[model samples]
Target: MSASPPSPGLAPRPAHDATWRRDAHTIGLVGLAHGTSHFFHLLLPPLFPWLIRDFGFSYAQLGLLVSVFFAVSGVGQALAGFVVDRIGARPVLFAALGCFALAALAGATAQGYGGLALASALAGLGNASFHPVDFTILNKRVSTPRLGHAFSVHGISGNLGWAAAPLFLTGLTHASGSWRIALAGAAAWAVLVIAVLTSQRAAIADRAPGEHGPAHHAAARGEHPLAFLKLPSVWLCFSFFFFSTCALAAIQSFAAPALHTLYALPLEVASLVVSGYMLTGAAGMVVGGFLVARVTRLERIISTALVASALVLLTVGQQWWPATAAGAGTAALVLTALAGLGTGLAGPSRDMLIKQAAPPGATGRVYGTVYSGLDLGFAVSAPLFGALLDHHQPAGVFGGAALALLLGVACAALVGVGVAARRRAA
Candidate 1:
């Protein structure tokens, strides 16, 4: 016999529907904040050429400017996680946004390199809080089944922020004939975003998991602040991020010029090619979001993607194939996009791996410490590759990036093994 239809009263909303709605709202707000962080990340790099002309700075000096930004961000991020754990993510998030706005304003009105350096340092201070704040909220608030997609949305938003920066800043500068005006406009945009986020603060505010019970009690009893350093998995995760981000740093800081040198492409075309990589990487994140839910072996997913990405980078670095000029240009763009897609697919899996490795009650600290590796990688890449460019070794940038990815593959494998060993022991 057929089952009877449920009565209207009994047929009320499924629990998951409400849960999904909450997840959507939470992810949306967090993603917006994350995107703003990334948008500011590129605020200076795209204008490097202009800065060179205007400031009379050497390539290495300009690279040092970026290095200082991420170096400060790296140290502050690890510390900010502890703050998020202690004070909650909401206030820290607000403070970060305020810092970003101030940084932009400082940059806009700056008269010299000293002022710009100060602005970059302030921006780094702002940038430091985002990963800790974002992951703490997501882990605490989002339901389990939908977390993969939440991470995907988060990653995609960041990539979109990266993609948007050049278009917005460069277009404004071209139209206004003043980079400072473009920066001031960015500052204004940050304030508007801050206002919008403040209005929705209640929905996204969340204490780090386990904040009110054992962890807090333990802290009250004088638990060591560096207790998290005992976890082997944390260091492994940190290494993964450090090596993986080297590839990203190369793309963000050098891709346009690298393509131009390799393929004889114009600046506009090279910039477009870099933009394509970011957009396609965002699309790849969408695909990975779906894959993460279904794929049981997250490590294999991450490993395979990084390996493919490395091969693509190696191919481009070698400058092989595509004998004709037209073919070479086409090859460069295609390879870059493919490499982006591969890494994009890995993004959600990487986040999931970190989530799995995090200890109870310490998500904020773990994410903060591990993600600081990205800042360290970014800090190192600028001066390292800037020197290459200074010496007329454009190919070395991509080659070094490819090497980083290969090393990243090893790191991913080691992390997987480390997690597995810990689990088996447990």
Candidate 2:
């Protein structure tokens, strides 16, 4: 049966006839887009073993590859947002998907470090465009009340992708006995997502026009894109997110290994613990979405959360008794979970605040710029923590992360002040 198109002035219907079916399909589309992007992009940590064994790349070279992926993306997102504002989400998304597809194909065929680096950069470039476009679309199409849940759901989809990528690549390569073949399979998934996106493009386009008002407000608010650079609130948000994500990336990328080194836990057990942290994070995101609306003082909520996260994380590294290992593990899990939950809770408010702070019509640029701070956090954290782990105990890394979170708390408090000032001025 032919699916009916979405009603005019509404968000695009996923090429499905029934409303429920269409909503499911749209969600799936968003999920798949995020899934594939994260799946491909995050393949690095696991692929390290493969690359080291197969190509004899040093730790330094591998580090460079990972850094390039995120660094390019840091800049690329701004460009993507600009492109999104000018060309609209449909075209920009397709373009990003296309870049992803090509990058995947290239990654599968890479013969050397240089080849892999090129492929990674291309994939990062492609992955960069998804968020601004997806978030904008969801804010417009999904009901406002449900937006938090929608964001959380979308976030979980990405987290799921993150959790699964290493295992999937491991299983695929082991089964096929060929890393290239496994990577090729990954590339094929990207191709399929692109095709799905293409088939549904008209439907998505028809759903609703992009956010013209905020986009315009964004531009008007800042005569130049760099105008927000001087704003304390803008930089404050940047600093807050930067540190929050630094701790997050440390946990995401290195916590398990750090635990393994500290305790005698098997790699498998440590892996499970990390997975627990991430899985719980999905739940946190959903819950956080709900809490964001209920909470009266967002700044206080943010500040309190940051302080709590710092305290919990710092506890993981403290001196204790014989059961210290077990206790530390439990503490790490709890602290990381709290941190993740707080991050989820503040996610929407953070973005909305950034939009609010932005000069009118510059939402894309403002978000893009602030988002670079996020990238800055991750890109810097992974290596810095790695170095700390190499020299000091795993506890030192956690301690450092705690300090960073404290910094974030301070930044969030400053944003609160700015919010109050903006209200009075208005």
Candidate 3:
């Protein structure tokens, strides 16, 4: 059967006039939303030391607070896609921002662990809607040629959010003489962002591919809600997220301590090494954005980048190079940055690959379901690697991380093959 014509409302804008401006606006708004979500993801964690002192909560208790956050986020994320697809992304996006504002307000006023946990849960619920909402809007609004760069900006913004959280939270706390003030400030910032996005609401309105039309209505009525699971590629994409996140969780949680333990590096130097890794990763995302615009072989890009990342991680894990205090620190710093760069380069291509895998008209649900693997990977990594630390095997943490990356490499290859096969069949 011949394919149906493109819906006029969903059609891409002409490339000649004002296209760049529109793309910029769409990307900027979506990127802002994504960054805010990520910023909140790390917001409470960085405040943990202060929370411990202020509330007399044990480390375990505080950790549970974050765990509750991820648990709610994971489950909510999987279900949020359905809502986005059903009602539309714009309202869901607005609601997500509201959740963040409420979460911050809750945290700011909370006097006990129970209140903090409630705030975390609210924040998680807010966080869950972002990926589905952002991606759906981007796929529908951004022109095809620049979609890659749009994804790149989306990713870089999230990294910026993560990078900003500690500085913003810490700086505000210092300035205000109380963490509550910082929390209040964050809540206010959410409201401000919401206002800005609301003003630009036309730019972000849900342009679901066939809104209010027969195709959309058919999809809504005829398709089973869980039909996406029938596709093998969806499961492969989920595995890709799962293992890749496992590798990232290891680096974020343990890379600094691993360096210090392995090389007798000063705490300050170890911290620098970790920071450099993140900065380089962000830089690599910029480069990857350009590469994705030019390269069509996304799977090859993903596989090669992940393989390089895995090898770099393994070299560091094994401590193949001899450890002089200065030399070891330099080696660790360079190697960590290289590893981050490799993964960063793969990120845009990775998102594109998932876009290919998603069944038609189901972008929101597909992303929501697959990205849950990320939260699952994170939740599992802490305890799994924390035990390595408990056993005084810091090197094991990097080793496990390398293993996870290698597994992710395998998953990437499988997904590529599956996608290629499907294309050939079509």
Candidate 4:
């Protein structure tokens, strides 16, 4: 492939044309769509206890349901990216949202494990395309200077989606006395988002056929279609996502049960830990957005933030809380929150790092391939962490998460070195 650089054929837009209003509108719409996808991530995991109680399923089996979801997603995301590049992002987004609604409905009607597995497969297929679609629109429509803030909002919105899911699902389940009704409610939420986005379709649409101008210059070079596969930075970025998401999978799939076993906290309160972590993480992304604006050494920021998070997880694993009920609960909650804060702080810089690594005119393809690592991490880690919980190794959950973060740190350092080398060579 040819050298990757911003396209020169298209002159930069004027401030008037790239007005704050225009950019903010696009960011807001894309963020909403992104948030909806994330909300679905916890669609079933948040209801795991109910599934276990109602179905008499083992923890590992329930964990495999999540694995099924992400495993399908990991494979589909790469193909979805190429599809987004070929046909346009808007219509694929519409179809994906429709899939979420159908998945939720399917879960509501499920009679056993087979039905639940079908729901999971449908959800995974829907989850596969958001990164490619969202980034394509942002890169194409949003102003260059505001791209940092766009990425920041994107990450913040996703964490907020994570924070919202447990509250929405569990709260509704508690109120209705049925997990099925709560899932039905989720289906309605998906439909509402789809309707709203369809109305504003023009603002967030970009994965269309042909003529992407400067971003599509690679095609003009007559280079092989898969030439992006050769970039070292691309695979390094993939490694970074895979390892980092393993850390996330530990928290998302097993944190509540592990915390409950370790600290004797109520299952309800233990679940709130995920929410607190995500909210604080969102706040960290707010700060990270600013850091990316001022600092160019994005990898250093990622490494520092991740190490801080890992240390906190290690502290949690050590179980240094006071023995009293109040003290122990507070300690577990606060320590988990601190760990989440560190993770959140790294979010924007992580996105920025991937953005820099992406080949020009190949945003959809690169992002699709790189972000698929996220699906693989979740697919693999959920089962491993769930088994740790099953084996009565509750503390291993936290320790394993910390270990994943440290491994991700190594990948990020190497990515930084690789990116620097490429810049010098260029």
Candidate 5:
């Protein structure tokens, strides 16, 4: 509900006092906890083939299994925000991680599709609880000056969770010849996270709660839940975020098989390629975080990255490289690496831009609203791409993804140029 003029340039500054440092550190612990949950959370998407083989599922069944989780998680984030405002981040996040671990263990031991579906839904519930809580803690606890970098670190940590999961789970799955092993590993990690958080509970309570914060009231208003639909910049950013996430969702969902089918690599080896996509994304988040400090024109940077990612995806999609025998793995790796860079640059900028669009003190609502765009993007695009994969050639799927990215680029560029002009005129 206030405005601050932008400084003409960026500079490195020390973070706020010891309290802020302590809060950020606690958040960092949460980030690692999120990463662990995400390892199990994300592991399912890439493991579709393995699951199918293990459980005898059809493509439609597999699609529903994954899509339902995201659909639920997307709605879950908004609910989580409201919960965070009311109860504080500590308890909600602790519960989310704890439940997530239990769900993973359940899914691992699931004997049939029915049991796995229940586990998947529970995992979705766990994920939905975490994001809003995590963002609220960062926005509320961390000081203003350090928010950007802290968010970047947080985003990178989450991406690392996404990146590390496939490799770690696949390995555990491989060694033990059971998906249950992977779930057990995730459960163990969750226990460790809970212990760490429990140790830091006292330090966490000392962080200042905003005396007059409106997050509680705004969420309670509940009317006009789709209020974000009215804003131009929101739609623009939504499109940008939507397309970017489409790329991300596809890679996360399909990259392993794409690699395996195209290159003839084993399931385990193909899983590593999927890891590259996630790892590269983690690297991208770290880079994007630093760039936020230096790059004043985020719209331009996001547009440029989306366009580049589109090109890279096109290249990867168009060529039929048999990497099993020769050098195709390198090509697949390179394309995903570039795509990851695009993700890193775009992810935080999109969040920052969306946060800017809302009124002050409403970051939680703004983020929750904008995040729906991500869900919508994934929800719509995954089915479209999956259908494309089923109906058309592999090349067609990449081409379609490129088209989405190009649309995203145009949307981001238009919004960026408009914002820049408005700021200059002001």
Candidate 6:
């Protein structure tokens, strides 16, 4: 029997869609785009074993690629914010994705280190603008009350991206017997995401005809372009990113390799530990989204969570575990994954605190400036930890990471106090 067409009154009406529906659509699209950018962050690192085998590269040489990538990105990201504010985010978004596709292709076809470096630079260029673009669109387009959940989704999607890269890259290589093919696959992913974003461009657009009020305010005030750089809380946020991501870069670059050395686990198995860490971290972001709604003091949440993660990393660094490698490996991986969960708990509060720090109408600039600290942290830490790995000190990666997290805790505390003072003064 042919199904009868629904009566007009019974049909689902798009006009009457709930507010949450529209917010969900915007949030979902932004999360997907954010996740894709993060997926490229690990594009080269996960292939280190393959690159080392093919090119006879040292840990320092390989680590330099990461340093180069972030160094380029840190400078460009600060500038990308101005472009985003001037030109609009949608076009820049398309361009960023295109660069990722090109980066992946460059990696796929590389014959040596220079080719790999070119790929890294291209990916850095792609990454340079995402935070500015993302936060601008979210703040402008999404409804206010849903913003906290949007940040949570953003953080969770990023962790998922970080988790997916190693498994995707290594699994493809092992299955297909070619690393080039794996990179080609990443290129295809970038292309697909670009197409998706282009189709939904209107929802994320910031430079639309009527959206010039914020830009006009800056011009009217005749404020210096670098004016936002003077805020104490802004630099404290930068310090927060710098120290925190030093710990993150350590894990991203060395965690799997360190696990392999210390535990006698195969590289493939050790890679799963990083994946586990990220997965559990994503889970933590879920609970944190709710936790931030109840907490008055964001710094306390940030402090407690990071301190816990630092302790776990410290424990692994101290090698306080069973005498047997098997027992120790199992225990260490569990502890590391737990640490990620604790860090994940800090994600929503971190964004909320940053939101509190931003002055009126300067979201893009403040986020761009502060987030450059993240790039700086990664650029400086990768080589330093690479030296530890070269010197046969697997545990220093975790210990150094713990120390960096402690620095981050101090910065977060300062930022929280500063924000509270500003509120009272206002």
* Highest-lDDT candidate: 6
Each candidate's number of clashing pairs is 0, 16, 0, 4, 2, 0
Q: Please, what are the lDDT tens digits per residue for candidate 5 over residues 189-225?
A: 7788778888876544423556434454655676444
**Candidate order (TM-score):** 6, 1, 4, 3, 5, 2
Using TM-score as the yardstick, the better of models 1 and 3 is 1
* Structural similarity to truth (TM-score) of each candidate: 0.94, 0.83, 0.88, 0.94, 0.85, 0.95
Question: Candidate 1, overall lDDT?
Answer: 0.86
Error of 3 at 224 (Å): 1.8
Task: Please give the TM-score that candidate 1 achieves against the real structure.
Answer: 0.94
**Candidate with better lDDT, 1 vs 4:** 4
Ranking of all candidate structures by their lDDT, best first: 6, 4, 1, 3, 5, 2
Q: On residues 21-88, what C-alpha lDDT tens digit does candidate 4 reach at each position? A: 89999999999999999999999999999999999998889889989999989999988888887777
Better of 2 and 3 by TM-score: 3
Off by over 4 Å in 4: 1-18, 207-217, 322-326
Clashing pairs in 1: none
Angstrom error at residue 258, model 6: 1.0
Estimate, for each residue in 1-426, the C-alpha lDDT of model 3 and write its tens digit. 999998886576664448888989999999999989988886576576588678787544655666777778889889988888777889999999999999999999998988898899999999988888999899888999889999999888887776677677867887888999999999998999999999999999865445562236646688877888899888888898889888886776567667878888774466555445666677778988989878766888888888888888888888887876458767876797678888888888899989988888788899999888787787677556756765688888788888898888888888888888888999
lDDT of 1 by residue, 1-426 (tens): 999998877666686577788889999999999999999888788887789889888778888888988999999999998888878888999999999999999999989999889889999999999998999998888998889999999999999999898899888999999999999999998999899989998778795444473346557877776787898888888988998888888888887887787778777777765567778888889989999899766888888888888888878877887535557877786787668888889999899889888877787888999999999998998888888888988788788888888888777777788777877899
lDDT of 1 at 51: 90
- What lDDT, from 0 to 1, does candidate 4 have? 0.88
Candidate 6's C-alpha runs over 4 A off are: 1-17, 323-326
Q: Please give the lDDT score for candidate 6.
A: 0.88
How many clashing residue pairs are found in candidate 6? 0
Q: Give the TM-score of candidate 5.
A: 0.85
**lDDT per model, in order?**
0.86, 0.68, 0.81, 0.88, 0.69, 0.88
Where does candidate 6 clash, by residue pair? none
Instruction: Write candidate 6's Cα lDDT for 87-193 as tens digits.
Output: 77777888988999999999999999999999999999999898988988888888887888888999999899999999899989999999999999999999999
